[model samples]
Target: MTRILPLLLLILTALAAAQTVEQEQQPIPAEPEIAEASAEEVLDIPPGDISPLAGVDLTAPGDITVMDHPDDSGDRLIVSFSPGSEAEYADLFAAYIIYRRPAGGSDEEWTNVGVMPVGEGTQFVDGYDPDFPVNIGESYEYRVSALYLDETEVMGEPVIAQEVASGQWFHQGKVRVLVACLIFLGLIFYFFSRARMGATMYLRPIAGIEAIDEAIGRATEMGKPILYVPGLSDISDVATIASLTILGRVARKVAEYQTSLIVPNRDPIVYTVAEEAVKQAYLEAGRPDSYDPNSVFFLTQSQFAFVAGVNGIMMREKPATNFYLGMFWAESLILAETGSLSGAIQIAGTDAVTQLPFFITTCDYTLIGEELYAASAYLSREPMQMGSIKGLDSCKAILMVFITAGALMSIMDLLAGTQTLSWLKNIVTTQIVD
Candidate 1:
């Protein structure tokens, strides 16, 4: 055992001696080398201002001029300038800032009023300040400067407006409107003259107007009441006024036939007006005693409550004919539907565009748009009323002619690529500016 242990120790010693010889045979790595720098090779740069727009030099704006804005109500001034050599300095041009201040005011008081794009002929309106609105007959100074892309601005010389802004007695832009009005007045005078000579003014027949008597006759034949809603609007509404006119006529017919009439009103003022109208009609028909005071009364002021009251009346009284004429809103459908359910003949007329569809759907006959306005004229047929309608018809015909001609001219200009008719287009499209 001692001999074996001596052999193992000899083997371990031999292995250690071999590993030390292998380590001595391997080569060691050397440190990296760097080249030495000369004193002249290192640079010490001083901090200096460098412009962002270093390559392009922008010139100041020139030929600054100011004038009163035309056709305005003495509230605006037009500032114009010439950005010199636009093509040469176009690279760095951003916009032109317009500066304005009261005359003789310090430079520090200058306010940037407006801006204009960089163009050869640049102009800016200087009177859009609502906080400090331009005063009439007040002197003001303005300057224009070129703003560069790098936030640099070069100022130009100042210019004063030659004339202060002032309002004109007659706007030149609305000359066409004035001419059209004059022509309409002349036409009205002509029609009135013809009507005074007992000439019959022909009008197109409206089915709604033609059906009014039929509705009244139906109620009379059935021996039932006629329900008339003068509308939810007050007496001030034109639709309500027209409804009252038609109401007077209807009441006269009902009085003549001795048929019961029921007029429900939403507005108290309209109820009063309707009551008087109905009474006058009965008097004219020689049946003033038959005009029931309780017939025409204010139902309610609340919108939906009025609808509910009218619905209750329709269900209980079971009217034979229903006439709904005036400015109606969302309640139109509910009223018409209730009358329809009661097997009543319904004639509805209104100027409210949103409620027209409901009336047209549920009512027997409906007066659409201007037909309601013309109902009184259609029924009365008085000389002055007929003449007025005729005059308005003539004006409408003239407008249609102008509109048709303008549309054709626009199409021709579009196809031909020529603006020879632009002058006519402008005249036709010119509107009155307040």
Candidate 2:
């Protein structure tokens, strides 16, 4: 009986130890109370709204008015208010909030349109939201409220105004540009009318133009073709147009002298125009049978490739006269040098300032900047063109006189410390209207 008692006691003690181990191995229960405390600490809310500018008195802005922004689209509203008495109190108020409501709308329907910082100018331009644009030709009530740092605001008395946006056919600001354009056109027309009425206009002789006949005659006598490069640019270029004009005159002379004429072009459009121009010239010169469709041909558009092709032509054909008229760039020297090497008499004209020196160095004759623009008018000698040129010259002369007088007056004003010519200076320099 005693041995059985001892084994029973051992078995009980082992069971108790096993139970203690099991309890220690189990997960502890999560405390909901601790989680609640942590959340409260992280996101604690204030008990009530309080003003940062509490205890400070601020005066409200008065006489708030709204009007249409003059000379502008109707989307803009110009808001103005009487300067607040607390202008010196920078910290008393945070900003002025502009509020607006449609006419007859309730105070609750007023929307916060814009905000201006404290100490800002009394005027504000409210360019409304593009997505919800303000209705044009509709009345609206506006108010300005001074906002405090503590989320408190003092509203001003509201005012009602409406504006309709309309556009003018002519902008008032561009009046000066319009007047200048009209005067220039009027002068051109006046000169053209006089030219048609038998007025004789004289143009200074351009040596490059004078040598055209001699160049064509030399080509005729030498029995060699005359090469004409109308430039490397497209027909859209004014220089190219001038080149084509000169080409017409040169083609007529070529037809009259019965000399072979060759024109190599870089642009396809210019090639086409040159061909028609040459054909018309031949027809006008009573030598339509001499017009050859193959005379003007399109060369490669690549600058250097065109230069190479022209140089090859110059070498192979050894043309007696080479006319480089139009726009040229880096390849100007290449063409001029090749023509010179081929023993050809070259007459080059271009508005490209950089290429002028190259042509002048290698060619027999060269036309400078404005000379290219005047070439067509000078060559044609039509009454309208002559008269227009004369008008332009007269304008230039008047401008020169004004410039000289202004300079003299400026010097006198500086030396004498007087504003005697100040009005004249302002009249000359200032635009008619801004």
Candidate 3:
């Protein structure tokens, strides 16, 4: 077997050598020379017919229609044309260039407005050009030309629009937005009416709000003052307003429990509002004389300085219960840590997302996000407040359902390649300009 293998190898080596020799002996072919032609020869046009319109289709685009653009702010005109001569001379047609002039204007006034590459789209909007926007309520005439690739064009007859561009009273595209808004308003009214009739609208319990009474009671038992910080924001802030509303409720409870209350402020305006709210709460609780004018006082306008002052109060007074509510900033941790170290049962609430982590870690119960805003309504449970909260929640639930459905459809369309739910996706993503 070894001897036969050597014989086969020798035959294969001889065959490879012979093929290499034959390939080396063959001659390589030369590349053909290409002669450059003149412009006339390349274009297939006679030298004498060297005009700009040479050998180009002179048939104009037909069925030119011009009108005021719909659903716009009265500054646009739409011009469209049919492929009459375009179909016959489709090979030479490169683009459709449009021109416009004032109505009844002469040929000298024809201005080159825009150029559209053929087959892209058959429509042109005149006022889309920022440099030469059409004036509203002005009449204009349009002319379209079929441009050929040979730097030549055939101009079409002019067409005048019957109606001048004008703004409409309502935008047609925002109908969906209008309908959604109307539905929300109707929900608000329905819930409002039901609430007025003493209907029991259920709301999920908030941990921070439920713990308020417990905290107040603990402070009363320990005979320690309750510290309430209405945040460090000004009076105009929504969080500050919500804090004030909550302050009224908290102060009334404090008044009823006959416990000492301390509210330190950074803004003088907030201090004024807080004082009034506390006094009114005392009046409401039938302990008007128990409301101390010095309880809700302005400490300082500086940020860190106010924190230092509040921390001092926490250390000295050793308040049994601490309430940190409103729009807190960088000072949130400083205040909450101080209260925690003082061994106070702390409850914090704020819409400030960045400060939530510190409060959650330090306080006993923390009202998260919208809970701070909903605190007043939850505590008061007034008919109007309950109704509005219920209506808002219902709208949110509906939106969540829509979002979930859209997400599912999007996933299905992506995986299965059906795209059957594209209409729903478009509706979900549509921008309504009102």
Candidate 4:
């Protein structure tokens, strides 16, 4: 059974929905037990009652009434409260009315129905205001709450209301969508950490990185400068980070071979970062003085300008080896073609999906989407960094499963038309998609 946990988790996730919070569709805060909370306690719902809001509250007392109006026939709803009852719950500042959108919809959006002004009489009438136009036939669900509003440790669910005429059934859908999100995020972080710990992982070899040593050695033999173009993004981009990491390794190799290096960047911040990476690489290789600060310089931020400047570098300096690493856009093919024209051995790494095809056709090597992000771990062998790669792989696997399942189920559902085997083929599609 433990071995089947992942599959079970998927099924549960498919069936799960989230509890609705006010206004925003955040997870309903875990409701405290009426007396004292127990780990296994759940919010209990009474027959014909509604939740104070829509959705399930696994951590809630589970038994609040949520209101729904199937038809606007009864334009007004009132909860009569006696003076004695109001005196008994002295801490209750006001009564609140909560409403949800249509069925099969998320309850994250909140429109306050009505409120009992502080010190107003105990009775409150919802949908009574003349200012808002009366909505006919449109269904509305409401939950009534008596709250302190400002106090932190507010206690108790007051009462709930629903439209008995064509009422929306609350129990039809996933109860804990918010909870599902938490579980999903937890899985992501867990696998990410596992990968970083050097957990045994096998990823397909990236051709671009595999050819780095050969490219650098060829540059060394030619006794010409080596060209390094960090992608066009700022240092914040993960692709840029990967490119810089590869540059660090490349810098060390250049230092050892006493080959000249030129790195042209499109951003000042990335330029600063790349310079530091090269200096560190040189310092690490016991040739601190060999690293040239002038070699790593900032070019304009324009994509074509950067591409043109790099093309000029290849033509003028004629670097024997050219590396285009980081995030790129339309200029990818232009850069690769220029490098090819320069007769320089070109090795490129980037995570841009759109630009990948151009690199594949032109450059000797290229790193695909996340693989460009994986170069640091591939070359650095650092534990935490390697774990990040593993996390990415795990995330990819999860997405693959989700996509494949969604596609197959959709096909099955199309053939079945929700008549036979509806449950097996149903997916949580949004109203937009439907």
- Write model 2 residue lDDT over 205-246, tens digit each, in one string: 999878888999999999999999999999999999999999
Alpha carbon lDDT at 248, candidate 4: 92
Checking candidate 3 for backbone clashes, the offending pairs are: none
| Models sorted by TM-score, best on top | 1, 2, 3, 4
What candidate 2 gets wrong by more than 4 Å, as runs, is 1-168, 171-174, 419-434
lDDT of 3 by residue, 264-316 (tens): 99999999999999999999999998988889899999999999999999999
lDDT of 3 at 228: 95
Compute the lDDT of residue 152 as modeled in candidate 3: 66
TM-score of 4: 0.55
Model 3 residue 320 CA deviation (Å) reads 1.3
lDDT (10s digit) by residue, model 4, range 1-434: 85699799987776663322224656989988788532122234454454333342212111333333323454544444333232444553344333334433455744455566557754555556775323544444443444432321222333333332233344334444545456666765776677656587565676777788788889888889999998899988988887888899989988988889999989999999989999998999999988788989999988898888899888889999888888888998999999899898888777788888899899877777767778777877666666666666665676677667777777776887755444433433432121
